[model samples]
Target: MTVDWDWSYTGDILPDLLKGLRYTIIATLAGYAIAIVLGMVWTLLRRTPFAAVNQAVRWITEFIRSTPLLVQLFFLYNVLPSWGLSLSSLTTGIIGLGLHYSTYTAEVYRAGIADVPRGQWEAATALNLPRSRVWLDVILPQAVRRVIPTLGNYLIAMFKDSPLLLAINVAELLHEAFEVGSKSLMFLEPITLVGLLFVAVSVPSSILVRRLERRYATY
Candidate 1:
């Protein structure tokens, strides 16, 4: 069966999709920043020498990782307001996405740190470097470089996942597609465009991440 394409409708819907695309990108970038920062904090906490702090961070991270993101999003959206806490849909969505992904990123960071040679730590100790100095000046830089590719992969994943914000009425790309399609009675073009846009962005990003990984590997 041949599929009919509607160029005119697609053209009419382009502006709305572009607006939504802006929000999607903004949310993705903001969420990624939060994830990276919070993930580092979580990783550091778990690696701390204090047994209680390490155990607490591990339990918290495991709980978050085990829970469904949708459930977490809905809980944040619906449950918090009853206790006098309220946030805009965009804010809630960004926070939820960031926190949810931070769990995964923390594990990535932990693996990276673990992969660092024990000799490096021993050398830091031999030098009488303070703990913070050792982490900042020596360990973190190397660990983060080793895990850059994995972290980049997560950013792409988070970008694609931003569409889930539409569930809470944050008008991201997919939400705008649905709105455009419902209003104009032309679902095919807008939906197809959204899918194409995601691929267009994600494929190139994945390639870039791979290239960076290869370049860093050579060093």
Candidate 2:
């Protein structure tokens, strides 16, 4: 009595599964957006001349990178309430994802910044360019171009990690699949669909990142 696949049963649950997929996509986009901005800020702070500021940023980034993302998500969603700061599950997931990944992305940004030519800095200094204008117009533009591939890779990583939002009850794709499969006792089809959906997206995204790398080749 081993019934493997049922097309009609899968069809019945497609809508609910799609709803979860939508939430997963939204959370990934929101979280990545925040992570990009926060990571850039951290990278810029790391460049500050003050030793204390640099050390503080380094220590904090290390602390975040060392921690498990699941624990961080729980702390933000559950424990923050005790400190008079509460967030919705989706918002908590977004912030938690942002903070966790920003630590890694900051290092990517730092590497990009380091790749900028020393001559460019010297030229800016010779031209009497304002510090802000030099950094804004010259450095970041070049650095961003160099780092797009790295950042895109992080985007894919963040997309995959979005399922962890289930810890905060965000109802992302895998969580939704689990819910439906649990009730119907048909885990195979729903879970298979989830894997297919992830593969369908991730493969194309990885290809796009590779193209971006070629586009920005050092040569």
Candidate 3:
């Protein structure tokens, strides 16, 4: 079937799409913030000297990373309410995106931490620095900087995946586009606008990530 392109229709729906874009950006930032902190915690938690706790954390991170994010979202949005853990749609989406992606971030942080020189740890210990001081004042500064590009890439990914919040009724960009299309009885303009909007953001962000990765690689 041939579908006509309507520039006028697109212009009319632009405002609605922009509103959704705002929410998309907000969700991405919030989710990425959660991922950043939780990811670091996960990486550090697994390094505990306690074997049982360390093993349990490793298993949990692996489980979270291996599972599909959509399934996690569904469980958080639908199943949890049944267990008396009801959460609003936006809350669920933020938590779901944060947690699901945090496993990957943890791995990135792990790689970053591994990149730190072993001698640095020895020096810190020899100086009688607390482990927390070693990590905060020395190790993490280098590790987190090295992983900036990777984390930025994930933020772009989470921005794209913000559409999945539709499953739980959080009206992000894709959901907004769908709603506009349904109301106007014209899917082409709204859907195409959504695509264009995603490209507009993702392409530049990807370029930035590449630049960051190259800059970090030099160091």
Candidate 4:
């Protein structure tokens, strides 16, 4: 069987796909920023001296990681409005993505912080440094640097996962492809374009992350 290809149709749908791509990139960057910041917060919370706070944070993180992100998005997008906490679809999508991935990033942070030489903590204690100063000056710098490549991997995962936001009506890349395909009743061109676009972006990003890991391997 011969398959028909439509170059003209592909050109016509390019604009919509590109527009979706813009939203995808925006969502990925915004969500990843939230994940990075909140993940560190979660890790620190779990490290608090109080057992209750540590247990609470541990439970919360585990819950977020254990559930499906789509369910979280639906709850945020659909259920919250009834509780007078309504949010825009895009906003809800970003929060869901960020909240879900923050758990994973928190684990990455925990590992990074653990890998810091024990002597660094001893030095901070001997210096009589304040807790904040110890973290900001002595610990986080090394931990964050060591985890940069792993964090970048999460960012790439977040980018690929941004399509899940379409469930909440966020118009990301795969959503636009579906719209184009549905209108024309031709799935081949638009879907193929989406795959190609994802590959184009993700491959280079993965390569960069690998290079970073190699560069920092000795540090």
Q: CA lDDT, every prediction? A: 0.93, 0.93, 0.90, 0.93
Instruction: State how far residue 72 of model 3 sits from its true place (Å).
Output: 0.5
> What overall lDDT, based on C-alpha atoms, would model 1 receive against the true structure?
0.93
Residue 173 shift from truth in candidate 3, angstroms: 0.7
Q: How close is each model in CA RMSD to the real structure?
A: 1.5, 1.7, 2.0, 1.5
- lDDT string for model 1 (89-166, tens) is 999999999999999999999999898889999999999999889999999888878999999999999999999999
Clashes within 3 Å, all models in order? 0, 0, 0, 0
Off by over 4 Å in 1: none
lDDT against true structure, model 2: 0.93
Clashing residue pairs, candidate 1?
none
Over the stretch 104-165, how does candidate 2's per-residue lDDT look in tens digits?
Answer: 89999999989999999999999999989998998889988999999999999999999999
141: Cα error in model 3, Å: 2.2
Worst 10 residues of 2 by lDDT: 78-87
Off by over 4 Å in 2: 1-3, 126-128
| Backbone clashes, candidate 3 | 0
Off by over 4 Å in 4: 126-133
Residues 30-92 of candidate 4 have per-residue lDDT tens digits of: 999899999989998998899999999999999999999988889889888999997888888
Q: What is the lDDT of residue 200 in candidate 3?
A: 90
List the lowest-lDDT window of 10 residues for candidate 3: 210-219
Superposed Cα deviation of residue 155, candidate 2 (Å): 0.8
**Residue 19 in candidate 1, Cα distance off native in Å:** 0.7
